[model samples]
Target: MRLLWPSLAVVLLLYPALAEEHNYQLAGPAPGSIRFKWIHGSICAATNRDPRVQAVMYNEDTYILRENIAIHYDAPFTYLLMGNKGALLVDTGATEEAEYYPLRATVDAILKRWGDLRGKTDLPLTVVLTSPEYLSENQGYRQFVNRPNTTLVPLDLAKMKAFYGLTDSWPNGTGRIDLGGRIITVIPTPGAHKDGVTFYDSYNGFLLTGHLLFPGRVMISNDADYVASLTRLKEFSAQHPVKWVLGSQIDMKFLPGVEYMRLIRYKPDEHLLQLEPTALQEALATATRMLGKPEVAILADFTMRNRVGPDERPGRRPANLPRIPQLPNLR
Candidate 1:
């Protein structure tokens, strides 16, 4: 009876890890759900007083945050991942002013709450970027300056290469950060911008694509470079099971190849922010089609813009939109 009780206790302690391992083997990783609704902008920007940031807790340790469209037009998404040893903050955001956008205060509150729960007073934080060249994706890097126990990562390719210890084989080689038990693989993906990167989380199977594969007009800095990056992602996803491909923005509507126009304060029926592995496959297939000719490829989930920045006037429609009759209000 004495031996039986000790054995039972051991089994009880090991059960969760063993079950998680089994689940991972069966599917990608333990799948999580979106717990919060996204904050699309309003028609009247001045009247919109929603919180500057919308936060969703994917799980106890993983959080997804987005700047309100009213706060910044880009409304880029950021992530917070906590592990036993430390935590990583992905993308500072599009805003720098605390008065207008309170990302720093919001992050600090989350950190304090997590520290209290984990019973660790001195938790370290590492700040990183998704797309270094995009101002909207990295304007908030300076917000973490002089923050206690926080490391602000560099936004340039050279410094980032050295910081991630990828200087040996940069832009082609992979880098990683061992957040205690949860390892994050940083894959260099510099097509959308010169220093963009995609993050893969081992713990939850999240593939953070940054601006590379968002549900919108995906502008390419270099088609060849973009193709190489997409190929890298395809090879990587084949080896690792990815539960979700979270992107930086949501510009397309639920309808196929239909996107919200630029500078529109209110976005009606914005597309789901989360995408599946199939979307990545489709993106690669489409991007490959635009190798030499740089024409726009209007795909169901995304539109591939061959150039960077605003390539067209705000409301100018693309070449080949599906011919669906408009609703009463739309017409």
Candidate 2:
């Protein structure tokens, strides 16, 4: 009986992880259904404020506790909107199980949030692809293509929707979606994620960068395109001061909280708080130094050319992957 109790407790603890393998009942359109749950990643918690409304705040990674509208959910992260007007979604979640990268439940959940936005005046929603990897863009075509309310904007429609079914109306690269009062703008910031698009929210001074701008690690994108993309972001930030930088993956310390981003330039705008030049310089310096490594540079290049990031190799070097010439020993 003593052993039985222990065994039962162990089984209970394993339920949630096991449940992921099987299809679980989704918390569809239920009023006041906004609930936040902690999922381990750079970002600690993802809130499902209905489907049309979602947000993610990094616990430790990137800017501390910076919140952004999460577009889709690949289990961990979800999409977010900037007010009721328009939204910039980072990743495209999986579709169906048998499909290429079946995480469409996230998108299905998103569309159901505001009921039906199709032909309903203005319910602007633009999806931004931060990284152009397989999982990032695959299996997410149906939600954007068929949805009546949301607009599908891709940098390279052929590259973004390579394996998925796509329609001719899908906007490629630069485009704009009117989100009621605000506008969601898609600016192509390739490199970090091949053909990855960085979203700019002029209303809130928020930049939704999927995996493009991580705080702790070096901003590595070996491909010239990816490197150029980050450079573009830096230039944009220098010109148009951004108060907050929202990213998909990050490693942070807090459970759940919001952090203030130091605005370097653009005068004290209404929505953003001004940051000291020193702080901004330090943050950018740290980010720049990390990516300066040869290995990191190589990895970034590989990510851009092959449209893939470093693979998880347990004990051996990743097969056929590019190797950094003077790689630093990463623990």
Highest-TM-score candidate = 1
Q: In model 1, where do residues sit more than 4 Å from their true spots?
A: 1-28, 307-309, 312-331
Query: In model 2, what lDDT does residue 275 have?
Result: 24
lDDT of candidate 2 over 65-87, digit per residue (tens): 12222332322233445334444
Instruction: Report lDDT (Cα) of residue 41, candidate 2.
Output: 19
Candidate 1, position 172, lDDT: 86
| lDDT, model 2, position 266 | 14
Residue ranges of candidate 2 with Cα displaced over 4 Å = 1-37, 41-76, 82-88, 94-126, 143-145, 154-175, 215-219, 251-293, 296-331
Name every residue pair that clashes in candidate 1.
none
What is the number of backbone collisions in each predicted candidate, taken in the order shown?
Answer: 0, 31
Candidate 1 C-alpha lDDT tens digits along 1-331: 9899999999967653221111122234655688556878888888998888887788777889889888787788999988777889998788898788888888888877877666656678999998778888888888889999999888767898899888887678999987777789999998888788999987788889899998988988888889999999999999998888988888888887887887676776888888888888888888888786646777777888775355543334555656667778854
Q: After superposition, how far is residue 175 of candidate 2 from its true place, in Å?
A: 4.8
* Candidate 1 accuracy as lDDT: 0.81
What lDDT score belongs to each candidate, Candidate 1 first?
A: 0.81, 0.41
